[model samples]
Each structure stands twice: as C-alpha cells, then as structure tokens.
Target: MPRTPRTFTVSDSIVVAASPEAVYGQVSRPALTGRWSPENLGATVHGTGGADRETYVGMVFDGHNKRGPARWSTRCTVTAADAGERFAFRVHAIGLRTPRLRGPIA
Candidate 1:
C-alpha cells in the first residue's frame, strides 16, 4: 500500500499531559526554563514585569569563512518572548530552536 500521507508539520505537536496552563507557567519564565533544561547553562530575563525579554547563554557554534572549521562559542539571545500562552525563543550554533505553548497542545 502507498505510504500514508504525512499530516503533521514541524510546527505541529501533541502534548500528552494534563494542565497545560500549569506547565506553561513553569516553562514560560526564562529562569525556570533554564532550571528545567539541562542544555541551558543559564538564563536571564530582562525588561520589566509583564514585558520582559529572555537572554540565554549556552554552548553554541559558529562557522567561519570558506574551508574553515566550525567553532564553538557561547550563544546569546535568539528570541524575545512576550507574556502569553505561546512563547518563542531561539538558540544559535545548535542550528535548532523551540516554541513554548500553553493550554491544550496543538
């Protein structure tokens, strides 16, 4: 039989858990995220209450000129998330990023 069509996209996901709101609260904060994520060595929140930006510092990579080998360096802020059910952040060098969501996994 022909392979089933893939309906899911890289931006789609299903979170098997209860209380998405609760989980969002814990993960929304940068400091909290850092505590929960081992890859994140440290995270600091800037700006003021309600409106804040998260600056992250962790192991990252950087590519040099042509024929140059990749170099590892401390990565910096990749995204600035506002207070909400859905938040976004970026990680450099790792060539990957993530989005935090709350209230029912989509």
Candidate 2:
C-alpha cells in the first residue's frame, strides 16, 4: 500500500463577548489549543523561539494529539494568519512520537 495525502479540517465557532483580537489571541497559541480542542494536547515548538513567538504564515509547530490512550504527533505549518480574523495550519506529517511520516495528513 502507499500513503496518500488527505484533507482534514476541523472548525467551529461560537459567539463571544470579547473582541476578535482577544479571541484570536487565545486561539492563535498552539500551546493553548488543549483547552478548547478535544484531541489536541497542545504542541511542542520545533525551534528556539518556541510556541510563544508571534503567529505568522509558515510558522511551524509539532501538534501533540491523543484519542483515548493512543497518542500521536503531527508537524504543522501555519498557512493563514490574519490577526483578529483568522488562523489556520496544515498537518504535513505525522508519527507515533514525532512527525516521521512526511506528507499531508490533515
């Protein structure tokens, strides 16, 4: 068998009392995703800047995820960044402990 790229998108929205900037500020951080996301266990940044760095297109991070007892990680690159508007990333690789399977998984 051969691995093939797959498209996966997860998105939801709820009305908030705060401004868009405040909402974006909270969701933009890969480290804080665990709070709102069910499978995400946050992320481990690949370099020195860490996940605390400013959000921008092309920013890379390792997404830590879990389902019941199964655990996995995915390499993601920020594909969209519009402060106070939108933030998105694409999963380019995945693995048990690290992103060793290089290709799109989500």
Candidate 3:
C-alpha cells in the first residue's frame, strides 16, 4: 500500500497584562523561550559581531528542540522584526536526522 502524506497544525496564544513593547521584549528574546516552552530548548545566534539581543531581517539562528527522547536542531532566519508589533522567523529542518514517531497504538 502507498503511504499518504501527513499534515499537522499547532496554534497557541496567551494574553499578557502589559504593553505591547514589554510583551515583545519577552517574546522576541529567543533565550527566554526555553523557560516557557517544553519543546523549544533554546536558540543560538549564528554569525559574528551581531549581538544575541539584536534581531533584524536576514539574521540567522539555530533552534534546539526536544520531543521526549528525540532532539533536533533547525536553522532559522528572521523574516520580520517589528518592535512592539510583529516578529517572525522561518525555520528549516533540512539535512536533519529527525525521528519518525508512530501514533498511539490501538
């Protein structure tokens, strides 16, 4: 039998009782995400001279993630970084040895 491709989507949101700038300060800092997210262990900024606190378009970084005993890294590049409004990065998992986990047994 031929295998069908699988797709999954995950979404999450939280309400913070603070100014947008304050919230952005916390969320945009990749170093702090590990404390809140169970899957994201942390990230390391790539290249030289660019401070980890400074994020701009085209900036590159590596994200470390864990799912139970499985661990992997993903390369990310900043696509948008608007203070107090929006910050986004694109993740690439190419050339990674990611494990394929089977669904729960019936």
lDDT of each: 0.39, 0.89, 0.69
Question: Which consecutive 10 residues in model 3 have the weakest lDDT in total?
Answer: 97-106
**In model 3, where do residues sit more than 4 Å from their true spots?**
1-11, 94-106
Query: lDDT tens digits, residues 1-106, model 1?
Result: 8997554324656674757656656655555544655445334334444214332232122211111343222223424333335544443332222222222221
Which predicted model would earn the best TM-score?
A: 2
Identify the runs in model 1 with alpha carbons over 4 angstroms from their true place: 1-14, 49-85, 91-106
* Top-down TM-score ranking: 2, 3, 1
lDDT of each residue in 1-96, candidate 3, tens digit only: 999966654567788889999887776877667877889877777777544557788887667778899777676778888999988876654323
- TM-score list, all predictions: 0.38, 0.84, 0.72
lDDT for 28 (candidate 2): 90
Candidate 2 local lDDT, 9-43, one digit each (tens):
77877789999999999889998898889999998
> Clashing residue pairs in candidate 3, if any?
none
Backbone collision count in every prediction? 1, 0, 0
